[model samples]
Target: MPHRSISAPRHRAPALPSTDYDVIIIGAGSAGLSAALSLGRCLRRVLVCDGGPPRNAPSPGVQSFFTRDGIKPAELLRVGLDQLKPYDTVEVRAAQVQRVTPGFQVFEVEAEGESGRTFTVTARKLLLATGVEDELPPVPGMRDLWGRGVLHCPYCHGWEVRGQALAVYGQGKIVTGMALLVSRWAPDLVVCTDGAGHLSPNARRRLRQQKIQLNEEPISHLEGTANGQLRHIVFKNGDKLARHALFVHPHQHQRSTLAEQLGCRLTSKGAIWINKHSQTSISGLYAAGDITPGPQKALLAAAEGTEAAIAIHETLTREECPK
Candidate 1:
């Protein structure tokens, strides 16, 4: 991604004191970093705190992103951080935000550093770019194959597993929908419901039409290659099925509770609810990335971050010069 050079303030405001930052962005993934870049160009002081490893840590490469396709997740973040070096106003840290206290026009944030040292900081606006956490099933070897043979988001990894003997894992209507979606990538797909598929007659008919095999047998475990790419689905009855990859739409939850703690409205699916400007239900509180309701992708998160940055700058401008 090309870095935007900071030329002049968008609304012509004097620099804030070093003691206070304009925005505190949590999570240093694509969303947070992209926001910092945009806000920095707008002459906004940004402090980005990375709670921990990104949600996509297990993924080997990022697909579907423009220009930076197939880049390692860590390397993409490294390049993003490196590009922010020219923006002096933007500061990135490895601190984990412990708590956030709402105040009149500012928010007090407590965080702990790598050395276990804790400090408090204040920012006028708070952006929670913190993403969500994938809750995979309890099946053995599932975690090990995650991001490799066990995958999510067909757009992100479908092409890599395309034409491979693939299976979709889940149950009920969700799995049926997933199998149909994965079929676009996998011409011949298997739907493994683990047990009692709970599929409707229509769903079964659709699967038959698409030639998707439904396996309701409970999976005992998964066997994979030496490199951890899944190879087989072992059943409780000693039966085994060969499969190169397993696609799963596992359950997910917010990685951070800052949004919930601050009483921000959440969607039915537990994502932060934001308006057109990315501002959450709480004034001065915003969210982007997978934390908010939308498709979870690096490119989409970065785009949302850029949009949030522009809106945040505008909000600040209005506050400073309210007609």
Candidate 2:
């Protein structure tokens, strides 16, 4: 048999007359980058627009991602960009998408680059890999400690602070559930209602049954190290609790309004609704990552992005190259 070098076949989008692309992915986080990798490999011209400041940018390291665990978030993104260097069909830009308008057979995307220059491009498909923004609690020092000693997603940061004195801070019914989740990492867990006192008697009983302490006193402020490592939480009544880490359920909103402006439906949780293939309610528009309703994680978002790209490629093939 003739020896054949097993090289990855390079695929490029057919040269179109206009400056348009097969797909334009907004927010070049894990999901957007992963989607671009798949689409580029399939010969689709992909453009990923990353505005700035990723959701996990404040975090020192990304956790729970297999093989790349503990790598800094920015480094992970840099690695992803490096991996895409071989795919000539894929390009990344640091720009903010201002608007997306549907066209005859494409979508018009207007974006502003860091150099204060504006540009527009047309794309056959749009992928909203734009992740959500974490709205931290208003408590003093809380925002500064986000993604550090103050964190969310126990599965993501739990092991890092395992066995440390952990505190869950929030109000209303959600905090009760959060307390239970945080207990897995630190048995010595405390739930602070921040003076809301929304927990029912039954909820209090449940916490006590699990040996979790419940504090209704309003939090005065959070005391942490200069580097964002939480040390103590002071109460309004002059009481202080020593805690190494605080788990919070911070409110989150979509980072970009482009999806909403495009008329895609959102979930009750304020996430972009997508089908199993990651297609949004609008045809030719897709979404993935934290913007979708699910337990948000880096690996999960990457997988969802891959799925959305495959679906987009298949749809385009069926429409453009029918048998």
Provide C-alpha RMSD values for all models, in order.
7.8, 7.1
Any idea how many clashes model 2 has? 0
lDDT of the candidates, in the order given: 0.90, 0.90
What is the number of backbone collisions in each predicted candidate, taken in the order shown? 0, 0
Candidate 2's C-alpha runs over 4 A off are 1-19
User: Tens-digit lDDT track for model 1 on 202-296?
Assistant: 99999999999999999999998767799899999889999989999999998888888888899999999999999999888888999888788
Lowest summed lDDT over 10 consecutive residues: which window, candidate 1?
A: 10-19
Where does candidate 1 stray beyond 4 Å?
1-19
Quote the positional error of residue 122 for candidate 1 in Å: 0.7
Say which candidate scores most in TM-score. 1
